[model samples]
Target: MYDFQKTQLEFIEHIKDPDNKPFKHPVESRRMDIYRDLFFNNIKGFLSSGFPVLESLYNEEQWNSLARQFFATHDCRSPYFTDISKEFVEYLSNEYELQAHDPIFMKELAHYEWMELAVSIRKQTQKWDASKTVSNVQMSQLASVVSYQFPVHQISQDYQPTEPSEAIYLVIHRDSDDKVDFTLITAMTAHLLLTIENNEQLSIDSLNTMMIESLPQLDAEQVIQGIKQIVEQMIAQEILVPYSISE
Candidate 1:
């Protein structure tokens, strides 16, 4: 390899893991120290802001140690700072082994927090049509339906759960006002949203048929009524938006 490329690799290694990878290139120690601190601090700050609840559960020393480990270990795919939270969520989900002090809900909570950031920043291509009927609909681009074994939305320093609760479902969405919020939803609502998301477009009658097929024990008329109410509520929240088959 060329000398410049080798030096660049060494520089990055030292920045990521200053404790072990010595900066072998003849750079001054003070300058190398500044680079290392600046890079690590940027990552740490993003993580703290992205997962405030997760950060709150840890002491300063523990949080820094966790952030440092992620910095040294994870290979982030995106180059943008806004993407760091997503990378951190991926790291927690796939790479990092849970330490004793790490909360069991760490992965779920991190993902929940990341979803809020993601929904807030997502670009919406389709304009909302208030005049469209609720018969035809699609899941909003700015919304997501997620389920977790723990109540990640309720997790905090004072309310940490040691044992997993019943599976909880949530619909996190960015509204027309560009405000991000989450609504705790029943499993049926989550299922309906996911079905709409996967299918691209569905009508209230079609959804009722699907639900009736899945749940034969329920009366057909009652199922239809329930689905209509659900669709109307979702449309009101802008979680489900009108879509024509042609579009």
Candidate 2:
């Protein structure tokens, strides 16, 4: 009798290889072809939705070529269909780069575009504190939050007319409603968020003082207001979970 597991593995290998001898279906060869086509088309459709902008950027030939390459190279770990996009994005980050003069902005553009789906699927585990004091609070030590080096916020695949003269900054987080929100943030704001994540004990006033010195363009009032706005939004969206209130 055939070892079911080994037989299944052999069948999978056969299906993946166009050169391999076809599996003898009890029914007919045409049925096997139909199955093969269905498998390939389903994966293609899933990838297309995951990387819409990337698909639009490249011609059909180029897009298919990349997809084939991705399929062959990456050993996806997730069994769930929804996680495939995350795996594809991870592949791009590790293995792909824009061709010479192709578009310096391509990498960031892909990242910015991918964030929509990434944030939508992200599972948040930490609880945030709403009443925590902001003044003099240490702002550098939160792990749940993510920060990126690229100025990805400026390029809009849909709206922007001309390329930007300067780099952009962005922050992406899941709100309370389970919706992903992307916001353009300043270097100081980014730094402040990082500080909060890093330091166990921080004061709100000290954070403000640091922001004023770190970002010379913004005055104290503007910085304070900006922080307040972000905090409120974060709280409402559930990005900032309630931890503990200070006395």
Candidate 3:
């Protein structure tokens, strides 16, 4: 019985790291190679899909080294395929380190790429009225309001930032067409979206009123007009979906 668990763990560890694996099972090396390739390829696919931009930034050899290290060292516990990307992010945070030539913002870039897929698959947690007017609104789960130290939205092969600059804010979401959209916004706009997101207990109208009251220095009518335009735009872009009770 003890040998059963020991062999199981040995097989798993060896499959994850075939090159320097300590355990030599009684099985033939050919069969073991098949097992190793199958499992590693499955994980590699998820890693690539979750961080496409990061993968593209590296040449094949560099990318393979990183992926191999993660596959061997990271103990992923998620049972869902979709959760693999989440595990990849956690692995990056805890277990992975950048090479000498790797970008300083590699982890942040990977995280930014993973977020789009995360938002795409997120289930809407609340029922919203599709027919309701945009004057009052609630943000959908599809939208993710995030702030970064660097402009992650503009990152590419050419636009790497060497130093942290001003705070960069963005709202990312999947539209009705199932296309992911990134909207660069001001800090103030990010706050407005966040307010709608966190204050689930209150309706949008009540929340807006509360927010405007808190900012007493601003003209009340002007603030309302600004918020109105933002909400309307979000609805038009399908970033925010409206809903109503069947009354």
lDDT of each structure?
Answer: 0.88, 0.61, 0.80
Model 1 worst lDDT run, 10 consecutive residues: 126-135
**Highest TM-score among the candidates is held by which one?**
1
Cα lDDT of candidate 3 equals: 0.80
- Regarding TM-score, does 1 or 3 come out ahead? 1
10 residues in a row with least lDDT, candidate 2: 135-144
| Cα-based TM-score, every candidate | 0.96, 0.66, 0.90
Q: Model 3, poorest ten-residue lDDT window?
A: 128-137
lDDT of 2 by residue, 197-244 (tens): 665555556656666777788777998787778655545544444444
User: Which wins on TM-score, candidate 2 or candidate 3?
Assistant: 3
List, residue by residue over 114-184, the lDDT tens digit for candidate 3: 89989888776656666655435667778888888888878888788989879988888987667888899
TM-score of structure candidate 1: 0.96
What is the descending lDDT order?
A: 1, 3, 2
Model 2 regions lying over 4 Å from their true place: 1-10, 17-28, 97-104, 124-167, 200-242
Per-residue lDDT of candidate 1, residues 48-103 (tens digit): 98999999999999999999999998999999999999999999988899999999
